[model samples]
Target: MNLKNTMLKITTVVAVVISFIACEDDFATVGSSVIGEPGFNASLYDDAMISAHSYDLPAVQTNNLPLNLLGVYRDEVFGTQEASILSNLLLTSENPSFGTEPVVDSVVLAIPYFSREVLEDDEVVYALDSIYGSSPFKLSVYESNYFLNTFDPETNFEQAQRYYSNLEPQIMSNINPDVLYETESFEPSAEERTEYIVDGSGVTDTVTMAPALRLKLNNNFFQNKILDKAGTASLLNQSNFKNYFRGLYLKADEVSNGGTMMLLNLLHSDAGITIYYKTKVVDATDLDDDDDFEELIEVRRSYTLKFGGVRVNTFEQEVPQFEGENLFLKGGEGSMAVIELFSGPDANNDGISDELEFLRDNDWLINEANLEFFVNRDYTTGTNLNEAERLYLYDLNNNSILADYILENVGQPNSTSSAANRLHLQPLTRDENGNGVKYRIRVTNHIDELLNRDSTNVKLGLVVTQNVNLISTYRVLPSANPEVQRVPGGALLTPEGTVLYGPNAEDEDKRLKLKIYYTEPKN
Candidate 1:
């Protein structure tokens, strides 16, 4: 029998069997009887040689991120991390006019937090999401003279400008001496805010909005910088306006005892600086009675400057030292673990491990391969840190997701549900008490390629991720590994971390390992 044709037929049969089992939601129960062939039998072999090492990540690119983290957080194991934001303001309209005698009433800056509405006692209330810690932190906003460019001049303006998370020091140097807004003890609130409006009939109406980080800015600064520059060359267009008023730097500082961190959606429609002021308008109270009777009256008006154009998130973290016993995975300029499968002595020096060569020589039909990582319960049992709900694995050499990840995520919606891609990248398993147990990740296709298709066995990078569906990679400045120039973008969006037992752990039962189930001819 031709070996190439025989293997092709076997691979096709395995694909059909796997698809059938996946439909039944019993993918892990592949047994010998499933093949339904008397000449073949299925078996399990899990003594694969594996090596894993943890490494600290350098400051990553944080500009133009989908979500921004603000405030401070101190992890018992990873030390303290403070997040801040630097964003350029955009004009609401070109050549905006505030009418006659535009006097500033109040300039308010509002950025909504990630929250969900819940009905309690027949009244609607909100519960915040993605907010870590409960302590207050100092928040300050300053006028920045630094220009955030759209493209990098070093790249001949062809590439988008990249900003690192550790660029806060350089940003601070360009900020104006006078602060725009400051709060010594600022905490995120879940209470709704009521905005009262007075119409022409002198009737007051109230409108309630969702929970947000709302602060009153310095009105005097807006009065001179904005209201006074109406119809001038500075306010002619967005380009001129951005240059005149660079932007604002929102900084977070640690408190005495503890600190809080919140993930904010700064690009929300309602997130911006609203300037409420009294402007001169024609009085229409008696205009109907006499057409010539024109009286200039002060009327309430407001205009907003949106938070847009080259927004960047800055992260300051304390890098944790890695020991070989356990692996640490954190997001946002944190650490990640490198994994090598079938990594043992290669006496032939053919670049292939001896253990992998033996498996290939057996001609065993690969059915399933998985990596199980048990969480280190000792460090996380009673801690306040919010552990990541998911972890992402990718090919470090190619800077892409593994073949198994792509196959499993097919036709699956982008969601945070643990059951979405359960067959491939299983979510963090939690016990009855909400403690993480272990994560079982399927690398069946990846293993098949290495064992049967003569593919290179590349190193895998694992990191805590906010969502598994986000496979886009972001460049990391000063990358620790030359092969690891980028990391998953979802990892940067997460503020959680986890510790897992590595292969070198003293507890052999929970040590990370690769288990492969195969089928072979009954010779």
Candidate 2:
């Protein structure tokens, strides 16, 4: 079958593994074999090397059904008389007509890295596939309730979620324990099982990976401009425009030459990993010929190729880098900060963007940005909201730019008045977590930047923000009496005396806690 048939869209080849990685690091040779060249001459009469390749590529079954879906399924099967029906899909397909036992050798699901977005009329939805090709699936918007509040629907899972699956027994020979699933299902939370997740009966399986990305970049135009620079991060300033005209340098170093082009690399999170293949002759006559072979081919016996994942960028605690925060414009005149972000010709051929390399080369000075937006309590009134709009359009570059990038049709609380359109911001107080932190992006603002990138720096700026994550926010225990409710919404979030982690006022995966003087959106 074609690749699109499977999940992750990875081809199951009886072929050697293929990893996507990036440029490498210095290597050390522990021992050396000294070959004495005593006028040694060896030559083949009629040199020829031919090979055949093929193999039964392994399948990726769900190892752990999925943490979030486990919760989803548990919630799905609630109040049903035969909860065992929840396990129906987990059962392998026996002959559909004969009514066979349908005991599958195994079943598996991908790990849950995404959460569902609730839709109109209370529909729970998730991405069916990926927005970016590098990712396996994208946004799958669906109804929230299989049976919300006494409502039940027939033929679940089909309407619940959409993903790829493989079932051929022969093809699943060597399964990836990390990606494999136990082919099991369970029920809702109860006194007995808090999360309703039963531990896997099988021992934890280890995963094997290779890191190496194949890279390719070709641009004859503007070769002179890029000619101004050259080399990997280590080769710094060596790949000048002159040598580029001469050619023969690593492709990554070539693009960093300062031209407008995207590059990719096969980045291996691990080092010294290589992809190897086992070969067999497609024609038996070649094996028996003994003389110069006639028919020989290298057929892949396993699609389990070993390439690598991109090595994560690492930075010291003191490095000058931009940090992220959530901005919830409740409004007043305040300052906002902006930090520069960059990208480079990728060393990996995974065909994704690379940014960390640019920072290291630029003395860690990222693109310029700041966190100083005005906070207006209610735009429905007067000058307060307009003042916040003024700073959002801070013309530091003086490019005659409007804050439109800030308040565009951002898939969220769109502005209602013409005044909301012209608001700008300046920083009042940035809770500097010391090492390096910045900004207060409204959660609405942050996610919007992540989704769209064409016009503003919101998405483009993420190259530097990738390492930055918004920490969890807790709406501190609020007091009931009116006397206790008089604190600022933002004040209640960060207890004045205590310190928070990671530079941003909030911790990982959460931030920009809004203290509501008005109605808060229901989560």
| Candidate 1 clash figure, as a count | 0
Q: Give the TM-score of candidate 1.
A: 0.89
Q: Residue by residue across 14-40, what tens digits does model 2's lDDT show?
A: 111111011111111111011112332
lDDT (10s digit) by residue, model 1, range 121-219: 999899999888888899999999989999999999998999989889899999997998998899999998876554643344778999999999999
lDDT of model number 1:
0.82
For model 2, the stretches where C-alpha displacement exceeds 4 angstroms are 1-155, 162-302, 305-434, 437-523
User: Which is the leading candidate under TM-score?
Assistant: 1
- After superposition, candidate 1 runs with Cα above 4 Å error: 1-36, 196-205, 283-293, 409-419, 479-483
Q: Name the weakest run of 10 consecutive residues (lDDT summed) in model 1.
A: 3-12
Error of 1 at 403 (Å): 2.0
TM-score to native of every candidate shown:
0.89, 0.18
